[model samples]
Target: MSSETRNTANAPRPTASEPAPGSRPTATRRQVLAGSGAAAAIAFTGAFSELFAGTAAARGHGGYGPLVPDPDGLLDLPKGFRYRVLSREGDPLRSGEGEVPSNHDGMAAFAGRHGRVHLVRNHENRVTAKIGVPTVEGLTYDPAAKGGCTSLELDGRNKVLGERVAIAGTAVNCAGGPTPWRTWLTCEETEDRAGTNGYAKDHGFVFEVDGADPRRTGAVPLTAMGRFQHEAVAVDPGSGIVYETEDAFDRPFGLFYRFLPARPLGGTGSLRAGGALEAMRVPDLPDLSSVQETGARFDRVEWVPVPDPLAAGTPIRLQDFGPKGITHAQKLEGCYWGGSSVYFVSSFARSDEGSAADHYGQVWRYEPQKRRLTLVVIFGPDTDIQLPGESPDNICLAADGGLMVCEDGGGAQHVLGVTRRGEVYAMARGRQNIGTPEEPEWGEFAGVTFSPDGSTMYVNCYTPGTTFAVTGPWC
Candidate 1:
């Protein structure tokens, strides 16, 4: 069932809104988070409670002028931002639940009991890998599964206080979003068949991990949200609408989606409470992906109901319900909610990949109130994703409302930052010798997020997976 308008006249909204694009293609921290209506509906909450207590944009004050190369050669920051390794794939945990799993991807930070910050992180390992991460027999739904999430408790000083397996028995637990009710929505990135590839049940779905104890949630799939190659999600707190993306890389490109909760008007406001799923449509453009310019805004977008979220064997764009009615994009990844607008990335759409659009990466902004999607920035092939960046994956909004994008394209990886004015800067670079040249620090960056207080930033390296807590001058 599609969601109906709610009476959240008293509900809390995000403190701001994205700067309306026009002659001004640029954005400001205030324009990205502070405003009214759709702008007021974001932030950490459950049953409606503010998670962040500050009115300042998360950006470090006026922003650290420029980055200074790290003498250590691991990460580079603008003079003040510094990071510390928090946990690694084989690090021992407080519960003795084995070492932290590899392929760290999507993650979120939460305000925990007794003023600690809790992190629910995903491990993208699959069954094929000989991973030792175990499933909580009683709390897991798929015993053969090797991918899941872990939890870390950190003190105010950016020190890890404890760690443990948060949830297990799932596959490809990639990028996920934090819910208002204090939970993590870990998304499975594969559409693996249940009976094939050493599997017993379906693999592609979203699972909820409780901020308090992610282990207990188990393998329950939010079937209503669709079972495709999900990349990331951004939830609208005011409307209980979930914005989704797909990571399919071939011909029939991926389609963007929205899940309307069934409980609000009748269904509850959660994936557990099944809801109606829909796709994006751009009426004026025949092929939305064919665009060639940046800073272009397209208004008059609408949503069409998707026929079968789970049984649809093809990427939703190739389904009967979509081709003619919906718009398609390639490698639609990282998506974040800010200033009443949804920011999404098309890591790289290319003609050789059987895509009509050929670009290294794309950043788009969707305004809920105006029902429009604007191309905020487009990176060309010359951007050369080999090292220092390309194919921006998981994303987090900085304190100043700029973007902290995790690079997943090619060569060595790094975390790149984008100013609200559309300038991209190198925030962190990945490096390692690993006793060999072929495997010299090739893991991509993912799980970009910030502490609720904006005092710290967190990110992950996808291989020999590791998580780091960064603290420094961020305006």
Candidate 2:
């Protein structure tokens, strides 16, 4: 990694319990969640701010108590909460196109016509996968690639109305974000090019999926967004700027990117017109995990343009970036837009992997207005894998004003909740036995999204491909 810190003087260090040089004291969790400095404060920005505001408005208390074990050995939840399996791998679809593809990954929910909800889900399968997304007419991107997205429709009662292939033939369709115009930006988490592994066309691009009308989703890749191992994206509602995360784990690591559209707020097909793709830089900080302090603030944040977003030859991360090389992180995953900032996650980092520092996980808030970045949440390297504060992957602002986080770590898998007070609770657990009876294995949860009305929570189990609708007294 580059040792350049041309802008290190701009960053001011502060502990969570202390205030910056001359700024006001940071709000306590109680004060922040109590509607005081809920949105403006850096501690409660992005999904944290949204969670604080929503929970404060609803007068919510410490998360929904503790999680109760499930007798079915499927999903364990709170006492009042319950989960229903909406779909599973090999499940027959109402459209009769094919069965639900495996590797259920990232997803988003949008309001459908006449009191209905449409969910666009990704299948993180590769070329060799057996149960690949069905190649539907007008929806197939690369017929040789096997991963894509499926759209599911549900009535007001949460009953399945229909299911169809929203986009097909893309590779490693991982996590993505929902657009304000009611569409899902599905990301391909691969960098395979044409003639690679029987691929018919180049992979690794963002494709817009219209949950309401699949026909409107022409399976076109947004090349302007750049080609890399894209993990997830969060679109700024007001600016229409798309913030993306790269999950590459090689030497140089992956970078955090943002795409400024040529035609902002132009809805669905606007991204295809082309735009500027840039990688983030934090002056002197070369790797993200190096910042250990929770309240660490980088005031002079910068974005370096990607010489070639298409990566025709060298990958973006390996590309030259003058003297100050682009900043990178180990496992950059899961991104979401909330309040006036964009929140992104660094799943974990290790010194063995050439990282500046080791950490269990981190949630960073970036404010485009001020061009500032703050480290709001940081899980220490000593975190217990059995606990709820480890390796948070896909994240979403809960309806009740807490952040819904999915566990993608080593130990037991869980759908955890992070309250404004920094309290972590297990909201749901997986009981699948991928191992022997003596050593039962579990799958990590992903795509933790909420319905438009906030009445239901939808998530996916990566293994065995299960989509669940969880509901109960949210507050």
Candidate 3:
């Protein structure tokens, strides 16, 4: 069961509950945000202008350390780290499973037998697959919905053992969260309703998939979690609450929400049973501009009950909470459950995206314990979106308590790292071009995550999709 020799016609598929080293660890919301981690989050420069001393459009040099360009030009990693292309957009499978799907977006790593791991990978496909992971009968909801997830096993050396479709026939499976109960929550990055986008049913929703499920359970949409252009989710183990991020790029902006499950701590399949979806509202913050000032801190924030969880026509942002001050972000994308808080990335606020106020990017830390959300690591206009380490998207916590952020902004994409000391570094930079002279590969990196034991890191190249696994003597 090796990556290179995976062309066997009848290779045994790896089980989701396949035993491994140890289950991934979890920390309480308070412990994650209490001391040093909280201080480090605040100092990351969410005060856009003050941190960089200017704007992203005008800024100079930034990045934790120097990126030694890879000789192959596919990725520029720091000195000690190295990466391997685990799966390509169109590689044929070894077990006759199917070709690796394109549009790789969100992903999670679950333990496998003998120190191995299972990566539940998502594809952000909007239309029917011209060419991608096909619809599996038992796993598909709508044949026309070309988006879904694929599960693959990785062994000790970080090589693919086998690949198979986990969930099938959904739409725009963007980014999702890894549940404490050992499952992946796949999110849809679309608001295109059923009849409008040629979809048989409403599109925006979240589906859960267990990597160890020896069988596919089909598409299970957790409607109670709300319906909109969902980007990602971060779970709070202590309280069965699921924090969700919306990727609405409109001027009105996207809302940060949390779903309170009706069935407390019901684990993976809990949301579908029912829950109360609520949007975040800060006391004094009305517009998105209030946080654009950099180093802006909003304490004592509360959740506003969403008027309509299923935002069919008028999204939750425009519903009742709009006037009540539901704080909005330019484009909320990737979010991770940081030990004591939830760390989320707000992809640059640009006027082009209908935003009056624009920024390179901003990272925020939401401390549920204190009812506070702090603005951290803000890039001004001077910051270079083209250079690397700007406009961050999908994020994951490192074993060392640092943050791994996928650069989704512009120029050459990179996997950026943020230390507890509030320092930002280029962990890995994309090199290979997926497009031709007319459209050379300029894809942003997504699905940044680490293996359970923290020996390896996995990330995705969004366009002409591809996934890479990097191993190194992590700092």
Candidate 4:
């Protein structure tokens, strides 16, 4: 499923690859896409493409400088930056149920009681995995399943207080979104049903995890979110609408979905109340990867009702959607809400795999008010997997109003930062050799998120399953 090995031998580097960091400063969260500031407006709009195209040899963004080698052979960061390993796979948890699960994927940090922070982390494990989430009785939805989420309690100084299984018995908990009502929505990235792979229940569904209180979290699935290969999700604060991404690569590809909850923002278990699920249809466009031009704008967008969200019969994407078929994209990975637009990522596309076109990656911004979706960032094909902008996944709005993107492209893994001026820079690197030292294999970084105050960053290494809290000087 990793795009690192894709054939990009003759592909051109993306226009936005490298740019010098200058006098421009980071924009605030509200200014990111509001078009209220010059830097914010130009950063994502078509102006960015023009700026990159005009510069022939520009390479630098005011990122913390080059990453210094880590003495521990794990993570590398800028000179002044420091990181602490909060949890690792096989480490004993405080709950005494089992060790920390493997394959850490998507995560979120929330404000906990008494000056503490709670991180709800996801373990992308399946039934065959050696280390799965601890199957706690009441918290376990299916003992046959091995993927779920765990909550780590940390003090103000980023010290781990306790770690417990928040939810278990799910499968492939890849990514989910933090709600406006102060909870984490953990999503299952599989469509396996009961009896399939020995699962006691359906696998592909969303579950709510209580960040403030792990004991209150349960393994109840939000069935209406549409059962599919879910990757990540983002919630609109104003509308309380949950926008989800499907990371499916089947014949029909994946569709972008929006769930209109019946009881929006009604605290913890509200999503279980169920809602209407619909897929986005861009009028004439059936496949989004065909859009090669940066800043391609879709003025009018329509939402098609998903007839069978539960997928008890046929999968949602295979269902009929009238003469005007629904729009689909390849490798839809991450979703995050910024300003008024909900941004999502298409990790990459391959023409040979039934895609209409191919590209390194694309980031899209969808505004509900305008009912429009715009291509904000596009990465042209490149031969180098080390490039910071390839196969971006699990993105987050940086505390400085920029974007923090996790690289899933093979080779050496990295956490990349994109400035408001469309400049890309390396923020961190995974130096741990998962394979033999003679033949190193770096794991991808996922769940890049900032604390409520934006002082620390929490990320996970997909292999070895290590969680890190990084602190550094910010702009």
Best by lDDT: 2
Model 1 error, position 80 (Å): 4.0
| Stretches of model 3 off by over 4 angstroms after superposition | 1-66, 128-130, 214-217, 322-325, 381-383, 435-441
Local lDDT at 399 for model 3: 58
- Stretches of candidate 2 off by over 4 Å are 1-59, 381-383
> What is the C-alpha lDDT profile of model 3 across 1-475, one tens digit per residue?
1133211001121122222222121211111111111112112343322222111121122333456767756666665667777887777755476777789999999997788899999998878554556777688877778889998888888777888888877888999998887889999888877776678888788988987672534577888898899999998877878899998867588889988887647555566678788888766565554455443556557677898888866877788765556778778887876556777778778776677667767777777766656665665343344555457788777655566778776566777665554455567778778667776667888898889987888888887677888777664
Q: Write the per-residue lDDT of candidate 1 for residues 1-475, one digit (tens) a residue.
A: 0111111101222122334332222232121211111111111101100111122333432234445555554555555566777887766677787767777889999998777999889888787754645777555757778888888888777667777777787888878787666778888888887786777888788887875665456657788899888889888766767889988756677888888777522222346778788888766454546875554566566777787788556655567764455678888898877767777888887787777867767777787777767776655434333444357688887765666788786665667665543344566666643336655546778898988887888988777677877777566
Winning model by TM-score: 2
Model 2 agreement with the true structure over 47-107: per-residue lDDT tens digits: 2443343243432455665566677677777777777778888877779999889999999
Model 4 misplacement above 4 A: 1-61
In TM-score terms, candidate 3 sits at: 0.83
Clash number for each model: 28, 2, 32, 1
Give lDDT: candidate 3, residue 103: 90
Error of 2 at 402 (Å): 0.8
Residue-wise lDDT of candidate 4 within 114-224, one digit each (tens)? 989999999999887879998987889899989989888989888888889999889999999899877898988888989999887877898888966656757787888
**Rank order by TM-score, top first?**
2, 4, 3, 1
Better of 1 and 2 by TM-score: 2
